[model samples]
Target: MKVHEIRELLNAKLYVGEGLLDKEIIGAYASDLMSDVLASNYLDEKAVLVSGLNNVQLIRTAEMLDLSVIVLVRGKTPHPEVVEMARENGIALMTTTLNMYNSCGILYAQGVKGFSNERAD
Candidate 1:
């Protein structure tokens, strides 16, 4: 999936990196725990991170993991500095009203695979 496709799928508000809409999203990782996010194996691939934690460190984690987009679930919005940091790092940021679980489910149903260890099947 592409960044713009995710935005339309989740009815998300694009807060940064409008220019990054063309970026390919090869996977998705949904987690509020920064530690878990940092530990995920999906970092090797281009992915969209779905998290409820709307902090600057979340952006930092995304950067460290080489993620292309951060999806803030449950309508959570990041601070201005978080947005700025994302823009500087070339990461796209978006938000949705759905909670973490719902967000993950929707994305999963849309052919977005989860991290290797996160797969239930």
Candidate 2:
């Protein structure tokens, strides 16, 4: 579903990249460590990285990885710089008070799939 579709479907609060509300998202990942995410090699263009840490680095990493959205878990809000970074990269940003697990569950229930094609090395 598109980011705006996600917002409407998930009732998410958009903090940045409002212009990209219609951008589609194919999958989601719940993580706190940016390094782990990088290592995972997300493998989806419209992937949403749901994390708890709200900082500039998160935005930088999201941009670097060409992610579609960053969902802040545990209600953590990103700084203005982070928002601007998302805007610059056209990556949508949002947050939810729901814990990571709950958020992931909700997204899944709403038809957002988790990382597929994952295999043990």
Candidate 3:
């Protein structure tokens, strides 16, 4: 799914990467634990992360993994530094009023798959 399609699907607000809304996302990874996300290794440049962590580290982790979009669930908004870092790293940032569970469900129902491939282990 495209970032814009997801934004519309979740009634999300886009905070960054307005020009990159058309970016394609092949899969979704929903997690608040940055360590788990890093270990999953399912996220690539084609994936989107739905997380509740509204911190600068989220941006760093996404940058390290080359993840394209970060969706802040439960209406959690990132700090200014986090947004700035995301913009600098060219990562799209979005926020949804729905909680993590609902957000994941909506995306999954829209045909977005989870990281079912081999784990980093």
| Clash count per candidate | 0, 1, 0
* Clashing residue pairs, backbone N/CA/C < 3 A, model 3: none
> Residue 29 in candidate 3 has what lDDT?
90
lDDT of 1 by residue, 1-121 (tens): 9889999989999999889898888888888899998887646538889999978999899888778789999997778999999999988899999998988888899999887774664
Per-residue CA lDDT of model 3 for 5-98, tens digit only, reads: 9999999999999977998888899889999999866568888899999999999999999887989999887799999999999989999999
Q: How many residue-pair clashes does candidate 1 contain? A: 0
lDDT accuracy of residue 80 in candidate 2: 88
Per-model C-alpha lDDT, please? 0.86, 0.79, 0.89
- Clashing pairs for predicted structure model 1, backbone only: none
Instruction: Please report the candidate that would top lDDT against the real structure.
Output: 3
lDDT, candidate 3, residue 48? 88
RMSD to truth, every model: 2.3, 2.3, 2.0
Candidate 1 structure lDDT: 0.86
TM-score of 3: 0.94
What's the C-alpha lDDT at position 44 in model 3? Answer: 86
Q: Could you arrange the candidates by TM-score from highest to lowest?
A: 3, 1, 2
**Of models 2 and 3, which has the larger TM-score?**
3
